[model samples]
Target: MKEKKWLRTVLSFASECRMKMILSVICAMISVAGGIVPYIGVYQVIILFLDGKPMTNGIVFRASILFWAFICLAGYITKLVFYAISTMLAHFSAYSILENMRNRMADRLMKAPLGTVLDQPVGKLKSVIVDRVETIELPLAHLIPEGISNLLLPIGVFAYLMFIDWRMALAAVVTVPVSAVMMAFGMRTFNKKYAEYMESSNYVNSVIVEYVEGIEVIKAFNQSTTSYEKFQKAIASFKDYTLHWFRSTWKLMNFNGAVLPSTLLGTMPMGMVLYINGSLSVAELTMCLILSLGIVAPLTSFTVFVNDVKAIEYAVKDADDFLNLKELENQSEQITLHRFDIEFDNVSFSYDADKADSPNYKENSALCDVNLKLSQGTFAALVGPSGSGKSTVARLIARFWDVGRGKIKIGGVNIKKLPLAQLADMVSFVTQDNFLFNCSLMENIRLGNPKASDEEVIKAAKAACCDEFIRNLDNGYNTTAGEAGGKLSGGEKQRIAIARAILKNAPIVILDEATAFTDPENEDKLQKSIASLTKGKTLLVIAHRLSTIKNADRIIVMEKGRIAKTGTHKELLKGCSLYKDMWEAHIGAKQWAAGSEKGAVKQYA
Candidate 1:
């Protein structure tokens, strides 16, 4: 049943190039026929040379040597030409279909929720997209149409031999069962082994990436020995597993290889015996030997594709798994909106919503029975300890993940009713660890609003206080971010991210630790700029520094995934013990920094 399903899936991909694949198969069959016809001519020519009589039904070779040679040469040329045409057609169609599958996978990801993409590891996803997808090319390009012909050409030769003598034909294929047993032994463990191999490869890739990304921290902490050992261990594990997997199958494979092409082993002796008897002629025995040798190459070629069948099945199944990930459902793109107020109506959520659909899913709620509202054009602040669901609240507002229960409305309509693109346009989320592409600063900022002009990008950058440092750089706005903004300081990346959000100018701006990297020197200016940019817009700023949001119209205190308090900063301090303790801690930390700075100044003086 699984084999049948795999064929259906492969045929579905082939249906896109059905005509091309059909033509290619036809050409391959013709190529094989062309090869067989020349073998017949060669056989007749041999008989003419030895028996002094025409072995063919006509006076073909006896008439002229040059004509027979020309016929053989033409036959070989036709075989070569049609084989080349078939290969070209097969490869062209295969790659085209592969490209389409990749595009469809990309589309599926775009339609999926952000949480769906985030939950998967970077290495695993990369493996599926780049490595696993490429594996399909082997079977699609070579094994489908060409492999069919490879199988048929040998079968055709065997049929002709059977017509000549059933005993010789049986002898020709006598070693097949032994070779088959060897092949089966070698490949019996391939599926499970290959899956493990892929898993190890993906782990190595992920470990390498992690090592490279954290190299600076590794050096700074002087933990090079341990970290490098971890890195080496991952690679070593993958290498050891791969070598063992290969070693386990290598001996049987060698035996199979030794036996598979030995078609002449039985045919030669059997034909000689038959010739000794009155049953076989010298010409017929010679023809049988020659034709049996001819099938060795085809038989070898056909068996080569047997291993590929498993690889193709695994590759196609992995690709299909990624492409079939459940998409986030939305009602329509044309959701009606009157205002941009954000509302959480008895909302609850969990990060593992993907697994939560299962009956065995445990309840690990990130937020539960929490309800809040941000009126239009209000400046609200979300404050909490680490993992208190502050970021989750902001993420929910941006529709990064759907609420497991209850409704989140934007402008009186459920946010789930808005398509991803429309929802993205409504919210501008700027986080501390926002990604920067390896491109010019102008282009990076313009990613927020792709159609934004150069001048507008500069304006937004200036507004976000990125213009001064940007201008001092060698290329100014033209400077490349250099691999996740490695060329700039953390503060600079933050400012650029804010500039992107500013350029977007969405009505709902959620700054999730957007100012975490800003130094004390520029924090006030950046805050002012942010305040100015978000004027008359619904602003939800999540911050650890309470001083920055002291003047916010509302300060929401979250504790253990529930709203503990909501008021102005002073009201919170007066009424909420948790808020009061957090404010006191913030002040103490600030005073400690001030004291340390003063002590350093005195020591320097």
Candidate 2:
């Protein structure tokens, strides 16, 4: 069954470029024919000499030599021309197929539930899309055309040998079964070893990416060399596994290699015996030797593709798994919302749905039986300890993941009924880890509204308090973000993200700790900019700092995935213990900051 699936995968991918593949096969067949013609020419020359033909002036010998030369020349020319054409067509088709596959995978990811995509590690996904997809190109570009020609040439030569002397033909193939058994033994553990190798490779990739992203933290803590140990261990593990796998297969491979191409071992001895007994003529013996030798070369060429075939099979399976992942159930109907109000009713969720049978599943629930609502244009704040489901609630309103049970509605309509694009237009979500592409600042902001004018972008930047810092940069608005905004400060990146959200001008906005990294000096200006951008719009903010949302219309304090209390600042202070405790912490931090500033001034004086 597994082999069937692998074959189906190969056929399915090949079917995408069927016409080109067929043309390539035709060229391959012609090339095979060309390769076999020289052997037949040699056979004919030997036959004439054994038929008692005179060697006068060596006329017949010269004519035979010339005939063989002309046939070989023409055959090779045709072979080169057709083979080149075949490869060109295959490569074009391979690239075209890869492009289409990547686009389809991207589209699938867009439609997939956020939780599903997040569950997969970044390194695994990269391997599937970049490395695995690229593996298919080898088989498509080289294996199909060359493998077909090589197999056919050997088969053709073997058939002619059988016609001349059946016994010699049988003797030629006597070692084949033995070699096959050796190869099968070599591959007995290949699948398990390959899987282990892949796991090690993915671990190495993940650790490398983690190390690079966390380099700042590592350096700040003076632990750069110690932090690098994890990455080094991962690389070393991969190397050891790869070498072990190779070593396990080495002896069997050598045996198979030595025996599979030794077809002439049996044919020469058997033909010589037949000739001595007056059963096989000298010409027939010569024919058998030459043909048997021809067969070995093509057979040896075919064995070289065995490892490539295995790689292609594994690669296609990996890519297919990702492409077939389940997508979120989103409706195609586009509905117009009447209001920007949001509601969460009897909502419960867990990240462990796929791992429900595991022992760790019980602790994976992120939300449970939570209920809440926000009126249109209301500025609501969700305040909670870490892992209290504050961010989950904000993400649910944006349909990042469907609730495990119960329903979430926007404007009194089930959010699932709205088209994804339409729902996206209604909400602008800004999270702390904002990803910026490597492009100009102007272009990055424009991503919020692709059709927005330059003037509009500049206006949005000004409102987000990003204008001054952007202008101070060497290229102003045209400066590049430099790979995930690495060139900019944390506060600067946050402001740029806020600027993007502000430019979007959506009716609803969700901020998941958006100001967590901003400095106190920049916080006031950013808050004012946010007020202007979200004036009269429904805004939901998840804040760790109690001071930031003190003036919010309502504050919902969350504890253990449920709402502990909901009220205004004064009401919450009077009734909610969690709220009061958080407020006290915020005030104490502020006092500490004031004291530190005063001591610095006194020291300077």
Residue-pair clashes per prediction, in order, are 0, 0
Error of 2 at 550 (Å): 2.4
- Where in model 2 is the C-alpha error above 4 Å? 10-16, 45-68, 196-248, 277-284, 354-364, 594-605
Q: Candidate 2, clashing residue pairs?
A: none
TM-score of each: 0.88, 0.87
Give a tens-digit lDDT track for model 1, residues 1-605.
26657667666766678888888999999888888878777776776777655455345554755566778888888888998989889998889778877888888887787888888877678878888889888777887567867788889989999988999999988888888777767667776787788678768988998898799999999999999999999988988998988888778877877887788899988988999987888888988988888777767775567667777777778788877888888656477577999889998788877655655433477887888999998888999999899999999998878888889999988888887788899898989897899999999999989999999999999888889989999998999999989998888898888889889999999889877777777665566557556867798989897877777889999988889999998899899999999999988898877432111101000
Count of backbone collisions in candidate 1: 0
| Candidate with best lDDT | 1
For candidate 1, give the lDDT.
0.82
Across 1-605, the per-residue lDDT of candidate 2 in tens digits comes to 27647657556555567788788788878877777777777777687677755455477767776887787678777778787877777787777677766767788888888988988888778878888889878776787678887888878888988889889888888788898888777777777877777777767877988998789999999998888887788888888888888887788878888898898789888988999998799988988887887777777775668767777777777877777878888788798777889999888777766654455543666887788999988889999888999999999888888777778999999888888899999999988898898999999999999999999999999988899999999999999999889999877888888889889999998888877777767666667667666777898888776777777888999988889999988999999998899989878887877432111101000
Models, CA RMSD each: 5.0, 5.0
The lDDT for every candidate, in the order shown, is 0.82, 0.81
